[model samples]
Target: MIIAQQKPIKEIAAMIADCKKVLLAGCQGCVAVCLAGGDKETEILASALRIMRKLEGNPLEAVTYAATRQCDPEYIVPMDDLVKDVDAVISLACGVGVQYVAERYPDKWVVPALDTKFIGGSTVHGVWEEKCGLCGECILHRTGGICPIIRCSKSILNGPCGGSQYGKCEVSKDVDCAWQLIYDRMKALGRLDKMMEIQMPKDWSKSRDGGPRRAVREDVIIE
Candidate 1:
């Protein structure tokens, strides 16, 4: 899932300082799971904006709405009429959701309300840690399911980098060495021999730096 964090209240205040009317659009998707831009967060932001602007002697209007999923056109379609007259839209979703709204409503000004952080899984309630880089090439099979690219301080391929000390990352003592974890996991599973195998250089072009990536499936395409 995409993890995001809400912008600061003061920063958000500046985005709508000149607008007379604003829409605080929320999504019940990834942003919701991260608790950054859900219905409750939207309401809280709307109220804060209203109060802050009122105190500034230039009161403004802030309307709140929570869509099923801001990334989906079906969920955002109903907002077309709503945006017809608003000054701007503050999307409380990830970058994808923000772009979807912007592309669909080219005439309206749209601003992002959250910072898209990473693709990750929650460790516990309210705590999310990144686990994947989505590099388009996965090596989990040989790496004992541990992602060295994202978890390791240095994205080393074959083994721990020279910076690793005492089975911990040199960059941070709290961080467990990704290669060390992989070694232990693979060894315990009777797959330690896989570690000695030389790994080829990663093809980073498959990831975002190459260009806009796309996946096609003939079975899923409509005529």
Candidate 2:
């Protein structure tokens, strides 16, 4: 899951000050889990924006809506009518959602309400720690499912970097060394020998370097 944190209210307030009408959109996916831009959060932000505008003596019309997903075109279709009437749109979804809205309605101004943080999962309520870096290649199979790209400070694939001490990362004492977890996991599964395998330098083309990556299923396509 991708975790995101909401932007400051003041910054959001500034973005829509010039617009007489604005739409505040939220997502029910990743942002919902992080408690940043869920349906409820969207209403909260709308209400706050209204209050702030009144306080600044520049009251403007604001509306809130939560979509099934901002990433999918089907989910965003419903907002076409609403977006057409608004001067700008403030999306509380991830970065992808903000861009999707802009792409679909190229004329409407779109602003992000949340800062896309990282790909991670919730370990506890309201606590989302990053676990993956989406580095084009996944080595989790041989690393006992722990991702070194996100956990390790340097993203060393082979083994624990010399900087690890007492199971903690040298970059930050609060962070556990990613390679340490990988080492223990491989040892328990009797696959520690796999660590000796060399990995070729990652091909940048597969990542964002070349262009947007896509997945196609020829069998699923029907004319």
Candidate 3:
């Protein structure tokens, strides 16, 4: 899931300093699970902003709504009535959600309330770790399900990189050497021979180097 962290209250308040009214839009998607931007978070932010504005004698009229998802047009469509009355919209979703709201309401001022983090999952409560580099390719088959691209500090394709020591990365003792993990996992599975095969350099074009990317499933199109 896409992880995100909320921006500071002061910074968020500054974005709509000139506006008397604003909508706090939240998403019940990835941000909800991560506890950043969800229905409850949206209300919390709105209340905080209202209190701050009241304290400053500016008194903002903050309203809020949580969409099932901000990335999809269908979910955003329901916000039309709410957008008509607000001076600006503060999206409490990821970067994608912010853009979706902006695109849906072209004339309304749209601002992001969260900083989009990486593709990751929680290790425990409140701790999220990045697992995929989103290189636009999958190489897990070659690496025993451990992603060297992201888990490896250096993003090495075939490596313990001469920098591994005591099963830890050279960059930090706290960090595990990704290659070491890969070697151990493969060996345990009796698939150590897979590591001996050289991996080709990643194709840069498959990732961000190629610019904005899109995936379309023709079968899913209603038209």
Assess every candidate by TM-score.
0.95, 0.94, 0.97
* TM-score of model number 1: 0.95
RMSD to true structure for each model, in Å = 1.3, 1.5, 1.0
* Between candidates 2 and 3, the TM-score winner: 3
Per-residue C-alpha lDDT of model 1 across residues 196-220, encoded as one tens digit per residue: 8887889999988799998889998
**Between 1 and 3, whose lDDT is larger?**
3
Report the lDDT tens digits of candidate 2 across residue range 1-223.
8899999999998888799899999999989878999999999999999989888898879898899989887899999888989999999999999999999889888999999999999999978899888878776786889988778888776658788999898899999999998888888999988888877876767767868778789999767
Candidate 3: regions farther than 4 A off: none
TM-score of 3: 0.97
In the range 150-186, model 3's lDDT, one tens digit per residue, is 9999998878898999999999999999999999999
Candidates by lDDT, descending order: 3, 1, 2
Model 2 is weakest, by summed lDDT over 10 consecutive residues, at 201-210
How many residue pairs clash per model? 0, 0, 0
Q: Best candidate per TM-score, number?
A: 3
